[model samples]
Target: MIFSRITEVLTHVGVITLLILLAVTLVYYPEFRLVVFLTFIMVITLTVYISRRAARKPPKLFDVIADEVRRGSILFEVDDDEVSRLLEKDFTLYEEFRKQSYKALLESVIIVPIFLWYFIYFYLILPRFVITDLNLRLIAYIIGFVVPYILYLASELVFRVKTLTYVLRGYEVYDRGIVSSSQYIVIKFPLSKDYLVREYSNRKCVELSRKHGRYTVRFLLYTKNTPKLTETLSNYGKAEVISS
Candidate 1:
């Protein structure tokens, strides 16, 4: 009974609470710190086990959507295979975006801890430098921090550009939304929402607006991919042909 209650409590406690509990235990209950740490590990392991079990038991979101469409409960004209393909494409794009975002974030922050260590190391070793003057040692210390910081800034800019470029080209279209690709900008237009579509001679553009048109996003699709995408979106939206 006690273990079950503990499990229930820990399951309801959020990540912040868990962190706070660990910190408090480390500071105030040194004798029981090892036990508390083991408990935390067990909680994480249980959570992972539960998550994997749930994942394995699913009719999955895509499968449900496809089933609903097949039964004519959802009025989409797409077949189950098309629905599956589109959902898979969206999932793949989302996963790619998620991974690239994690990489960019990791790259941006990895330098921080390393340079923090450098700052401390340089400050501690100030006296051992050949320049014995206090002023020179101070300058050296500041330089050590400033140079790495500048390099970090440059790396952050580069990663930001790379991430942006990756999203701005190779645009993708599906039943729910369009995925823009390339180097500068990425836009997603959901067909379920109110949107505007404009077609040019060689390309097509999708515009989605929200908050009474207070915010808008537009993306272009090349001519080659327009037909299938237009067919998919026709039931939800219409396109306007633009004169040259």
Candidate 2:
């Protein structure tokens, strides 16, 4: 905990120092304003990418690995129907995991081409104001807009789809708690009073929650052997089971 706090503090200090340097350069060196701005945006984007990647990295082997060696007894694998029921029951909680609706599909279809056109229009006009030579202006436009747009697209494709798939398809159950996947990470929740459990009417399914910082992480697990699953959880973690 102390190490984590120190690292967080250092991260903040570094970012603040970088910003101050950028500000100083922009104010004192007008000739390099464009370069400074580009550097600023690149740094910001790279920081975001690194932070997100770190957040999505998996935990320790014991917590996240799917190995046969010391795999602790397999409790259950969450199935499609179970996932569907959970989504149907508490969609607001897991809306991002749901399949894309027609409205969203339509919006994407409409917005992407329009965004491209907008970028193209600006790319054509903005450079003329700054650069006198046609070739140099085109090169500047490529550097400023085209590269960033491609990077944006690549990041979206790499991160978002994997995250969506993990949320929708990856869940595992063990004796103590549940293990679920997110983006490129696997999270383990230990069963305890601290974790909330909701049992549906038939005892075939359960929803569990753990508080992580300010956010609540929840998982739904289903099993054919409902009694055994409940008993195992109760015995291992003494979880308070709430009926829903």
TM-score of each predicted structure versus truth: 0.33, 0.48
lDDT of 1 at 175: 39
Q: What TM-score does candidate 1 reach?
A: 0.33
**Each prediction's Cα lDDT score?**
0.43, 0.52
TM-score, candidate number 2 = 0.48
- Highest-scoring model, TM-score: 2
Model 1 misplaced regions, further than 4 Å = 1-84, 89-99, 116-120, 123-125, 161-244
The stretch of ten residues in a row with the least summed lDDT in candidate 1 is: 58-67
- 54: Cα error in model 1, Å: 36
Number of clashing residue pairs in every model? 7, 0
User: Candidate 1's C-alpha lDDT?
Assistant: 0.43
Per-residue lDDT of model 2, residues 1-244, tens digit only: 3565477557645755675566555445659878976786677567555654544453232345534212566565666666666545554444554443433344234335534653464456563576556556545544444444445444444433222122334456665345554423343434445677777646355666665432355555655455665665676557777777
